[model samples]
Target: MNKLSIIIIFIVCLILFIVLSLSYTKLGTFDTVISSYIQHFRTRPGIYFFQCMTYVGSIRMYVPVICILSIYCAVRKKLLNICFLVFNLWGSRYLNQVLKLWYQRPRPDIHTLTTATGYSFPSGHAMNAAAFLGFIAYLIITEHQLRLWQKTILLVFTTLMILSISISRVYLGVHYPTDIIAGSAAGIAWLLLCILFHQRFIQ
Candidate 1:
């Protein structure tokens, strides 16, 4: 990794550490308010859209779909992006599960709108969305042959997908706002780590 990228990664890791520490200490008043607002949105029709989209974003089940597409792209274009796709798909899934287990925070049962199992300190949907979409964004942006407009469109769509998936978890009442925040932070950290590794060892 370049000096600048290393610095960025350090900063991200520092911020993530601080955030996770504070989140575990106690829920601040603002945190409570934001969580309430997120739960309020859960009742709206928009949530259904986000929920379905988030479900689709789940990498555990979606990777096979992506693998199929990746195979098609590889065969048609003679591209060798399959290794990168597989690495990202597997790496993100393992990291998400590890973080979830490490946190071990219980899901919100106060208003229990959905029947989700497992801990909830970090929203799995948010993490999966960010990692999956962020990796795609990185690939599109880094592929020198791709047109600028195409890269820009891919970046925007990927960002929207990440945001929508995050909102879905909060709206579904399965995760707190802080959970999504942590998940997004962790996901970005994972993405940066992957990029750094690739640049240093693979690129």
Candidate 2:
């Protein structure tokens, strides 16, 4: 949220995105290694868990959750937060779409636990979950004067949700590992921008 922290996030996200893009485009050895590693560990339980997580992460499922949170925020007169949440959710999805079209990466031709129809360089579920849950974590840390353990627990849960969704995409073979990495990087970058914009203009 601070300038230095924002700069670090930007730098790291950029590096991750660019590296993943190049590797995915070239089908490089590193991409192969990571994707193979992820696919090798797939199990029935893991697939079911990830399928559930992806459903939760999907716009179809998560939009209602967002709506409920927005309503709560509106009742509290936190208009800025409500706006930020909607903007982050929709805006990041749009951004992810743009990136997907630009890359036009095809879905992997491996066994998939669920049906998916879209370009797969960046998993939309991963991006959306990271952006929305990352926003929730950010709000918690900034607005609540909670104890250290409380903040830590919340942040860890948020991180786990993000990772679980991303890993699920890989396990289901709908996305390459690089795709999730890129999605996560793009999501964090967008979320950071939204956070900075809200902090600068709204509060």
Number of the top-ranking candidate, with TM-score as the measure: 2
What tens digits encode model 2's per-residue C-alpha lDDT throughout 35-86?
Answer: 7887788877877788898887888877888888888888878888888888
Give per-model TM-scores: 0.83, 0.93
Per-residue C-alpha lDDT of model 1 across residues 1-35, encoded as one tens digit per residue: 37597668757865984577466648756556877
lDDT of 1 at 93: 71
- Give the TM-score comparing model 2 with the true structure, all chains together: 0.93
Model 2 per-residue lDDT at 86 = 88
Q: Best by lDDT, which number?
A: 2
Q: How big is the positional error of residue 57 in model 2, measured in Å on the Cα after superposition? A: 1.1
Tell me the lDDT of candidate 2: 0.84
RMSD of 2: 1.5
CA lDDT for candidate 1: 0.72
